[model samples]
Target: MIEPDSSGDRPSGSAPETTGRFIVVFAETEADPPAFLRSAAGLSNVADSRDFGHGPVDPATAGDADATVFASLGVAVVTADPQQAGALRMSSDQSNIESISPELVHHALSQGTLSPPSALFQDTEHFTWGLQATGAATSPRTGKGIRLAVLDTGFDSSHSDFAGRQVTVESFIPGEDPQDGHGHGTHCIGTSCGPRSSREGPGYGVASEADIYAGKVLSNSGSGSDGGIIAGIEWALVNGCAVISMSLGADIAQVHPPYTAIGRRVLDQGSLIIAAAGNNADRRQNDFGFVGAPANSPFILAVGALDEQLDLAYFSARTLPVRGGQVDIAGPGYRVHSSWLMPDRYNTISGTSMATPHVAGIAALWAEATGYRGRELWSVLVQESSRLQAPSVDVGSGLAMAPQE
Candidate 1:
């Protein structure tokens, strides 16, 4: 059953969707997860990631393996019976174990349609309103040396604007290719890494020269399980992406357990994950929705949506009264123009989904200009953002800005 958002239209504020499989987070110092799982949980059909040599793991490739261990993040996604799962959860051997959780189902954070906003910063012959509003249009940095990861529904490799760019594509979803079936990933990729000079309209991308790592974590239908998303993160880390942009999330207010550890671990490795704060609000109806899982993890940066006028988007979620649930930054998301799938080629959409990649692209620019990574990169974004008059719960440190020099 899909729970309705404040607008009584979109799904939000429900118990998070979950897959029956369990996620096991091992202690960071655990040396051999394959042996630990065998001795503690008494199962042996495990696929160790060290065998795959640090690339994205396709779940289908695991075949009959009962558990798949991501060695870098020290986590495993296990297909266990209730007895087996309960044993791992309730085990007295707590030395090597951290947390066990049901894998969650996440969706693309788009509103699925466009809503006309009162015009403020209009698109010009050279730039989209988002690029103009965030100062990305005039910023000198092109993120030339940075590597950015966009983990979502996938990317459109056939898009004309990206003809000569370097892009690495991988799919973590079983039975799906990395080619984008849903337009969300393509749109996000355009916002973050599309070309600076385009035959289409104005330039909509932020970090034009950054290497693109498109990881298809969500299925074509716009939903994904935690295992696939985690796999994407591992892939991004292994590939040395300086920033990871996640425009997908579960609409649960509570912080998800796995991401707390995963987020912290990824940052320590010098990569930052930036996620949409969520599109569950309806301010016209006076319901300011809370930030959702993955985004709500303290170690990950949460971004809310703002319009060309620099006010919070009506659908952009408000900060939940939790440590990591607060919106850390804002970006132009309402009716933002960016790349889409072929034939259509371009789209104008609204959501925190659109806002996330703007900050991500800007993050790449900062990564290039300042040579900052992980926590330092996160700090630079917060410290350099333009402060707005709205409450911090709605806009955080205000809008994310591009580096001028």
Candidate 2:
């Protein structure tokens, strides 16, 4: 495990945080990945996903294994020395190995600063501003049969409002349980899958009836590496989650290779992965930051933040000129209200992080309403979105909306 670093700052041209380990992506035609690894790189202490039967891979139990292969994703997180990494790269030309890249460290993309807009939609006795802005307030579809996964800093399993909901929890962070220590995950859950009828506050969640799959990919300190994140993604895929929401990313302008492959594979498997465009922008100062890391992957849908007036959030990233760095959609994110830890009960924060779940939840509603998965779901979202005065580079197709019928 690396040291706790809460300050999410990586200078423009600086190298990103990496684990020194490498991720290996195998081609679909690879007959025996483990055997190939053994022959090519002489790696033996490998744990295969098939060993777990129907359950998810336990990172703790497989600690001793040098390489843990996720069968569903055709990916492996391998720990190797310089010699082994070089050998694997050389073998990729003749072997089924497609790409080898260093594993990156990712952090939760929550905004550090808060600035609520003065005018437009506000929370009422019935619904939060997010719901009103996205038309989730009147959407008949409740994501009834959809399985939505929130891969973040765990979740508050005991959160009161979600008592009777069908919530399945898992922790990819080795030492931690599924319970959320950082409130980001819980707040996101409240927005994406919290109950429709609340005991205290307005209905903050969008897909109130969607089954919740809380995967603790990030640790309690709100940081994690690519290995754990990949494990969580594999778990969600194995369990047939149609929509996966990631509110975390690394502050790298270049498109991360692993996420690019992962996003394409996830979409191919009939799932959609929605991620937050990093809160690195300060538009007030004309410092429009570009989308970063996983969100910059071409296959994954990147989301930007919008205030109540449907204006772009100051901290929301502007699109990069690169292929997949553009914001594909927008969501209510400024000073959004949602569930928090116990005693506090609720909290309102702002970020592209908050915007992600809004799109994810609304994706669930659309998934339930149209029976669409993967790319089809992505198309419907862009097609059904409400166009705004904001440029396409910033807001993409505009604010994503829930299926109203």
Candidate 3:
């Protein structure tokens, strides 16, 4: 493992302070890392970060070449700003994509770029749940102002409802800015704390007033590595986030090792984590079984998915590690409506990914009321969940309708 540079003196604090320096990796760029980082902005440290193989891999390097960068800089922990992440769209999704005008694109694109209104993101249904007289009881505490860290694709800062809200965007994929390329992240956030957008029951949001932290760990394609996720979780844990909505997952046996340590760290640091049980409902496994992992992390509240009809999705993974202490809750997942890539459209995409946010949105309400710590927030939510009558494997808690809606 690459070690932290013993040569540099870091400020002596229990926590590692984030340095302004950030590394950018891509198939392009032949310039030296030191020059690139210094040119991007005034950074104190920089190094040749990871080589994803797709990039220019200089074969002539010495021993301990690329991997040593992060362990040394200590700045390995640095974050990607909006100006740094600029979004990367899929090729077909790129043909029509072009540099936007108004000069603002300079700032928005350098880190992450939004699709031109006609590109692809069509805003869909609003995903908030804290309407006073809606699904849950009209309680005084339903997450009015707590902050939640959304670690997925970035959000639609251009959306009107998000107006006046404070958002800090970061990226893991180089050249990927905060502008969400895939509508998945937008939908996920809309479910958690989106504000009133349109009428027809599409404008009202859940936990509408809470602050949001945009941690873009997944790419616009709705995929990310366990390493990137771990790093993103670290950012959320130390950045004043009370609740974290991670609407994605990998199988119990498929995930990388770093995931175990990072998942545990996020929880130990007092952050409530909500993750999807995965959409891989086995074609072979009998019905009533939908447990998946990392989501199965005991400290994490693993959420299962149910369709619009209130029935579980066929593709939703069957719950396992059940007797072994895995799986936790279930929520509405199929055809759920939320934000999209287009500036004006919104749509409901199916998956346990959709279900995970409902729990997160609900956690926001709990935090607003009890000021519950991460663990406490999750505890209250689980205690109030509506479970399946038979205690089957597919639907963990049967149904997860928050008390406060």
Regions of candidate 2 where Cα sits further than 4 Å from its true position? 1-119
Clashing pairs for predicted structure model 1, backbone only: none
**Predictions in order: lDDT:** 0.90, 0.90, 0.60
- Candidate 3 per-residue lDDT, tens place, 1-405, comes to 112331222457753433333223322222343443344434434434454344543445412232223322222222334343232112112332221111111123365464422211122344232222124323344456677888898776676556687667788766798888877777888777775555645653566667788888888887887777877788888887888889877655444345556666766777788888777665446544445656766567777776544556777776565432355777767666667666655775778888777778777777776777766777777777665443456666555554542
lDDT of 2 by residue, 84-110 (tens): 776787788875888887777888998
Pairs with steric clashes in candidate 2 = none
Off by over 4 Å in 1: 1-119
Error of 3 at 380 (Å): 1.2
Looking at model 2, report the run of 10 residues with the lowest lDDT sum.
1-10
Candidate 3: 10-residue stretch with minimal lDDT: 97-106
Residue 189, candidate 3: alpha-carbon lDDT: 80
Model 2, position 113, has a per-residue lDDT of 67
Please give each candidate's TM-score.
0.71, 0.71, 0.62
